[model samples]
Target: MPAQLVWFRRDLRVRDHPALVAAAEAGEVLPAFVLDPALERAGDARTAAMLTALEALHRATDGALVVRRGKPEEVIPALVAEAGAEAVHVSGETTPFGRARDRRVERSLDVPLVATGTPYAVSPGRVRKGDGGPFRVFTPFSRAWLEHGWRAPAELPSQHRWVRRVEGEAIPDAPEVEANLAWSAEEPALERWHEFLDGPIDDYDASRDRPDLDGTSRMSIALKLGAVHPRTLLADLDRVAPKRSKAAQRSLKRYQTELAWREFYADVVFHHPRSAWHDFTDALARIPYDEPGASFVAWQEGRTGFPMVDAGMRQLRAEGWMHNRVRMLAASFLTKDLHVWWGHGAQHFLDRLADGDIASNNHGWQWTAGTGTDASPYFRVFNPVLQGQRFDPTGDYVRRWVPELRHLEGKRVHEPWKADDGYAHDYPERILDHAAERQEALDRYEAAKG
Candidate 1:
């Protein structure tokens, strides 16, 4: 039997993985992961998480997982020849970089490169409208996505026939970034999913907005590494939700909508590849952006003096992840308040976030920057102070990360400048007045729309 090359990119797990299953069906399988220099150099936190996930995939294949370092175009074809592989299979590529690489790899190959599945439940570029055009907005796309529906989780292969002829290198150790990496890997990821599905998933809608509460599934890192597929989560939700209370069922549905948002961004990025790096909307492109200076540095270092934004940025540095609500707040501060381009903040996020995806991270920043599909209007700036008090009513989220303000108790914690004696001696004063900056952002938006 001709051996099939299984090119592992994002999907790095053994269970419910489509590409691996298809390769197994065709013939003996050679599992390999190519570490692209671009991706490998991303950052210590993301690199560490990916290396850990690769380790899990390695163990799943009994150390037969091939780890090559090079461009996939150069690395894959040589491996295919060395192993005498008749076919190559992969989870379909969606990002522009991934797409270009796949096209090159396909061109260089003699055998057919079969794409079996994608990281998303409904892969981008597939979901469309009645006009056969991609859905630009999310609500209709989400409704259409549910109508389009995804397949049930694929069955895990019962056995493996490893064709380990071509030797591959060792998966590297976690890099020295000095930041804590979130999520150990596959087994831990699955464990987290099962644990979330058991209880907190019911209260997701309630606490998902509140960063202080233990309310979210924390499945992003898992989804990023493909330890557990969205279909698996959707399927498990189906199995367990039927017996759940109505409120719990609603929460499950709410959580599922979040999943749809992920797919929606993927769809958006797939259709408008240029939009990944530029504004999706033309008018917003003309908006004047300020050069990032000390203010931007302060934002990066979590010394912005806005409790919610500061806490969120610091949380990102400390945990390599931030709450969803906090992300919006931080993005708004950078783009709307500081007038720095959204791409700067997005790149910073990509550099840091373990779960960062080009689709979601870029589009999310565009959404806040008022430049993407169904974007927040430039006028509708987020009030970090109000946001902190509302979402983190007790101001615990801020105090948790911005410990300098720990002395200031309760709601008072959200506004340290409001302290009767000014900001606690160590903590910096408010970097930029939100009210002044809000007007500036609105004025700039008006001028740019001209």
Candidate 2:
């Protein structure tokens, strides 16, 4: 049988992987994973998670993963020649770098290079407005995306014939660089998804914003690594027996919308690749960036002195993740309060978050900075103390992540420095006054507009 090369990029799984299955069908499979220097140097928790996921895939396939460290354009052609492969199969990527890299590889390869849909239920850029233009707003885009739906999950291949003749290097024992935050990889990812389907998804709408509640799906890392395909989640949602309970349906819808947001951002990046580096709103390009200093360090170290902000930062540092509501608040604090450039904040998040996809991270920062399509208004800055008190009413979330504020108790934890006694010795004072900094952000926005 002719060997067919399966080039694994972001999609790393045995199940629901169309390209892998296709490669297996075509010929004896030679699974290859390129440890590209570009991705390695990116050196974030997400990259570490990818390496971990690759390890899991290696085990699942009985050590079939072929590890190569080079650019795909150069490495793929070399692999095809060495393996005598008939063709290359890959799950198509939507990011600008990915698209460009794939094009280069295709041109260099002597054999055919087949591509398939992404792990997402619907591929990015597939949904469009009635006028045949790409959508700039999410609501209409999501509506059309749902209407367009996607194919049902494919069955896992029972057996993949491996080609022993193909000589390749072994998978690395770990990521090239150490991860800044801790993260559970493939197995934990699967367990978390099952747990979410079992209970929390039912109460998602009512409790998701409540940091004290066990509410979110917590499957973002899995989604990012393709440990579990979005179809699996969509299938679970469809199977849910929608009862008259307002909370249940609302929660389910909200969870589904969050998935939509993931795809929405991916679509945004695919359509406007330049937004990866430049502002989505061309006029906002002039927005000033604050110099990195003590305030920025405080935000990164989780010593910002605002209970909710610190809690969110601590959660990210400890678990390689943060609650969705907290992500917004923390991001807003960086862009609007500290006056840091959103790109700097985005880099920090990418360095820590296990779920950090370039599409989501870049667009999320843009949304927080009010520079993306349908972004939060520049003048609407979140008050961290109020946000903490409202979302984490009992302060349990704060106490769990920011133990220094635990003794304060109740709503007071949100503003420990505001107590007549002032802050505890360990906890730092507020790095910058929110009201004053918020006004400065507005002034910057106004100046940029002029």
lDDT tens digits, residue span 1-450, model 1: 789999998898988899989999888899999988878657667787888889989998888899999988889999999999999999998989889989999999988999999999998988889999999898999999999898988875676598888899988887766454445477888888888899989988799999988789888877887877889999898899889999999999999999999999988888888989888888676788999899999999999888899999998998888899999999999998999999999999988887888889999999998888889877889999899999999878888998788888888988777788546458888888899999999888889777
Who wins the lDDT comparison? 1
lDDT of 1 at 442: 89
Worst 10 residues of 1 by lDDT: 176-185
lDDT against the true structure, each candidate: 0.88, 0.82
Question: What's the TM-score of each model vs. the native?
Answer: 0.97, 0.93
lDDT of 2 at 8: 85
| Model 2 regions lying over 4 Å from their true place | 175-187, 242-246, 420-422
By how many angstroms RMSD does model 2 differ from the true structure? 2.3
Steric clashes per prediction: 0, 1
For model 2, which pairs clash?
205-251
Total backbone collisions, model 1: 0
